[model samples]
Target: MRAAKGAKGFKIIGTDGLPGPAGGIEAVAKGGWAGTFTYPTGAKEAIEMSKKILLDCATSVEPTVTVGTTAITAENAKQLMGK
Candidate 1:
């Protein structure tokens, strides 16, 4: 867990919400759009943000493929599954 391993905070570059429930498998809190930033206040803002980001960067073409290239290391893997 980066947070537990002395990471104050981190940035995720080039990310998009996952296609299903598996998206939140590693989240610390529950709410908002899957894999999108959820403000403690609500999910609307996060959903809007996701929509804008998706619209601007990627097209929603059916049969689209998401190349799963996210890297995982021993140091970070635990953080994902939780303590």
Candidate 2:
């Protein structure tokens, strides 16, 4: 209700796409936030790298890996919940 409490003209955007009640996606779905982006962990990439190094005997792997993020807005906020 911050928007109704004089914050009207200000768009509420969240950086973390936390799910569930009172989370970022919920806030956006309920019209409390304008938008948000998902914060993903690199666990999948880590597991792949470990297998490559241990099983394939790779000498080296890329030190940095880029993980993609998903944008959450009113249009797709609800669909992302319980996911």
Candidate 3:
């Protein structure tokens, strides 16, 4: 993979099959807060692009686990507070 100039951060490498002569390596390195994707020569760019696409779908707030008929909303909060 081509390394960017004066950059430093973590890298995430992914591959479909075995890492041998038959199957090659696919790597992606992302810098801190910059949010960029890179790939090696002749390698399919879809994998790298998919990372950004998938990350775009990510949410800062995690999903809440609800059970039974428990109500968790502004109205519920108000009722629970006896307001």
Number of the predicted model whose lDDT against the real structure is largest: 2
Winning model by TM-score = 2
TM-score of 2: 0.79
- Candidates 1 and 3: which is better by lDDT? 1
In model 1, how large is the Cα lDDT of residue 39? 17
The regions of model 3 sitting more than 4 angstroms off are 4-6, 22-83
Provide the clashing-pair count of each candidate structure.
Answer: 0, 0, 0
TM-score per candidate, in order?
0.20, 0.79, 0.18
TM-score of model 3 vs. true structure = 0.18
Residue 64 displacement (Å), model 2: 2.3
Per-prediction CA RMSD (Å): 14.6, 2.5, 22.1
Query: Residue 58 lDDT in model 1?
Result: 47
What digit string (tens of lDDT, one per residue) describes model 1 on residues 42-75?
A: 3555566567668766454334333334333323
Q: Write the per-residue lDDT of candidate 2 for residues 1-83, one digit (tens) a residue.
A: 55464755778888869998978999899888899999889899999999999999999999989999999999999999878
Model 3 lDDT tens row, 1-83: 34644455754233322222222211111121222122234334554445545877644333332222222232232232221
Candidate 3: the clashing residue pairs are none
